[model samples]
Target: MNDPSGPDRPPAARPRVRSDLDGLPLFRGRAAQSGMIRLDCNESPLAPPAAVQAALTGAVQGLNRYPDNAAADLTARLAERHGVPPAALSLGPGSVGLCAQLIQIACAAGDEVLIPWRSFEVYPSLAGTAGAVVRRVPLTAGHALDLPAMAAAITDRTRLVFVCSPNNPTGTSVSRADVERFLAAVPPDVLVVLDEAYAEFTGRQADPLDGFALVREQLRQGRTNVVALRTFSKAYGLAGLRIGYCLSAPPVAELLGRVAVPYAVGTLAQRAAAAALECEPEVRERCRHLVEERERVRAALLDSGWDVPVSGANFLWLPAGPAAEPLAAHCREQRILVKAFVGEGVRVTVGTAAENDAFLAAASRFARTEAAAPVRSAALG
Candidate 1:
């Protein structure tokens, strides 16, 4: 009975601004296509050792019972491994969740969190969703972190700074000296989160920044402003379990736990993670294998005169640029799924020995095509 031209109803209220999402595909799932080599995500190519399997079987006995809410025992073992007190650690579903939680606790609308461009895709997205302004800095010319520029980017509004050592996608790392300089430059008020998810593969015996040691020193200085985020997912080969831990001051640890979902570190996850921790020898050996393969893959690419960057993570970063899409397409056509950077190039994870061989074949073919193109003429002319 009412007029058809009557004023339209107002739209329903929605979240005004999602943290750094800015229309980015933060949760895009991988496509399920046949012949997929599956090197998209940075997961360990190896499976958890047999001891871990047995431990998981034991936990199945308690499937009906709830997990240890405190995660105290696991946290204790983690603390001992790092030589810190149990009160200084907190576990999470994974290191990624802890990153999200840290932002939620410290960041508010208009506040800024500093991160790197061409690094972990999650940082900006998480910061944006947590209501913080994301300040994205470009990596240095060599693909390493631009610590100086990052320090310069910090302002009074900056609350958190995330440094992904052996950065994702690019596989470059900031040196210990650079990190020390960066820390010295940033204001003491800003909290620094050193994400060491791939640290185990770096092969640096006295780990740069020695995040564990740094956390302890920072806390002793009455600084509640530093944290080292590590995971059992990568080196421990338990990515499916999704267990990670943080080393920070107790107050900060407690704050993170408060913001964390109750029982997020699941029963199975905790037990499996604990079991994995006990097998340092096996875990270390696997990491050593990955490091070895990373070199083998890099050598083959370099011998072909491919302009591959020096990478330390369980992946390699290639220079695709204009050919990026086409190169990725070529690999995809052959049923190999690698992580493609629309803005940069392709990131190929160092998969199992067999998978690496397949990727190398694809890459070599692409390189030959590139070599035969007008690119040579343009460069010479």
Candidate 2:
């Protein structure tokens, strides 16, 4: 119930907005600039492939026409690709946007939504919008979602649980076995949202769980509470277009559609996403390169004396403890921007080779400064 807007609201404007809206935390990544290496947001370093570019250009000609609110082409394509009926799919502006809609579909005032702390930054805001109580379960010591703990935290009021696999920022993925165990323990009526936004980058990791596959299996078994959320933002490089989809039981998918805004997804996004699907080989290649860069960057960070986690996504977690902000500041000073969680840690995205090298240089400088500061203070003492 903490206010994201703090206590500075003008008295006149306070009553105009819902109490819940007054304190909703907004994402605050730094603006992109020329010559700056953005290692903050977990976005793909590559642009959409030539096919998408062509589709986008052609699609621009139809700007005067309204978009397909159903997102027919994209949804059908996704359904066909995943071998699921179109009824089980729900499309939206992006996975984050769909997360909000899903919350609206399942939760009401006084309900509760359980989320892993330090997972996706948007979870709290999404829950808050629905006037749901936010329950943040802390991650395990290994920076993984403690599924057992999360299951333990559930109550009669818990209506939804968000499980971000290959979890954002932390970059640790949940295995199929772990997910199976967690699902078995949770209440069958309570919806579990498995966010696999980073799944494409997780293929090289050990036994990465296919979230949609799990959802489909659950649906086949008549378990309708599981939903899988995915996006074209990361691996597909369609962040600007804002296209994402959800796989769920037909009933849940229907509810999601009810809460979604009509024509929210633009035409360009749908066309681009379909075109991106057509260029699957290109997407796979980009992911392959990013995974390689992720390993190289992670190894470099570890060698540099940082406690970088073994990541299954396109980013690395530097658990800098108290030095998190200081290190982030140092990186920014070196013209590199990384996502910092204040006292928690920093999430550095794996950009292109040159961008990664730039971040490495910044990190090296920060390490040297940190190393020398204590010695200098001791000498003075």
Candidate 3:
């Protein structure tokens, strides 16, 4: 049945690629600094270690050939380092990609995902792009994960819940007890994702439910919804390699592996990641320095009259809220660049001790000026 205007019929409305992405750079909101005291992105300040550098020198010979489609060596290294089976892991360009894949596995169009307000900003956006409705739960006064409210927000539509421990921009986490209670309250079919990118920096020996342990625990309890994610980008200083992973039940792992882009972790990344896994001493020392600097920097800021939480990650969170833009601008002018959230707060990654000193100095000046302005206004009144 050919219609008169069949050839001229309007093309069907094409859905834009992935719903929300408009060919925009994902990290567009974060300010960039070509060279400055960079405290914005939570990236390691140092270059790759000598061992990693040597490995890269060796890996250059293979760039011409296709990378390992399976990223087999890195997967085995990840499993061995974390004490999980290689079959339980799925790799990606970064944890963000892994999160996207997890959302794909867990949610159907219009299904809902739960994300925390003061946590990683990408959560809601990624979930939305995956055809899921994003459910945002605000943080508690202490800036910690609000488990009770999050649990209440859960409805039949909910499918995935992302828990970013030492949560980005906020720097707090759910306690072990809280995690257990939250798990108990959540339904079995719903996927719970625990992102532990900052886990290595924590000084404490026991983290209530280590994501690695949760995978095995969930299995022992006949559950299939828990997943733990980690990355070598932070402590290992491999941010440029774009390698990260999620651990799940073997079935879920299989699904994630199938959905992820083949060879997402390039051959170089695989080799470097494998080598990094064995350099525990180096990684641990760097993290220790970060933790120490986090304390020193936080103390310096507080002593100089800045309200901030003691961080468990490699960064500090300042409730700059309305002060964010100005503070960031001020820091940039002083040759330092720190993280800022429009109406939320600011996050400052711990750089080298000297770099941290420079940032603190800039902040002190900002705080002093702010302090004197009110007094001067009062005098005029």
Which structure among the candidates has the greatest TM-score?
2
- TM-score of model number 2: 0.93
Best by lDDT: 2
Question: Which runs in model 1 stand beyond 4 Å of their true positions?
Answer: 1-24, 31-35, 204-207, 370-381
Q: What's the lDDT of the predicted structure labeled candidate 3? A: 0.82
Identify the runs in model 3 with alpha carbons over 4 angstroms from their true place.
Answer: 1-26, 29-32, 205-209, 371-381
Model 2 misplacement above 4 A: 1-15, 371-381
- Two-way lDDT contest, 1 vs 3, winner: 1
Candidate ranking (TM-score, best to worst): 2, 1, 3
Q: Per-residue alpha-carbon lDDT of model 2 for 288-380, expressed as tens digits?
A: 999989999888877766777778888999877667788888888888889889778889999999999999988888777853343234324
Clashing pairs in 1: 19-128, 19-129, 20-128
Model 1 weakest 10-residue run by lDDT? 371-380
TM-score of 3: 0.90
Give the per-residue lDDT digits (tens) of candidate 3, residues 1-381. 657579967777886656345632365755455678888889999998889888888999989988897787778877777787888888888888899999998898889999888789788778767768888999988888898899889999999999888789878766667788889999998999999888887676454447777777877787889898888789999998888888888899899987887767788888888888778898899898889888889888777656787567888898766677778888989888887788667889999989998998888787767633432343245
Local error of candidate 1 at 158, Å?
0.4
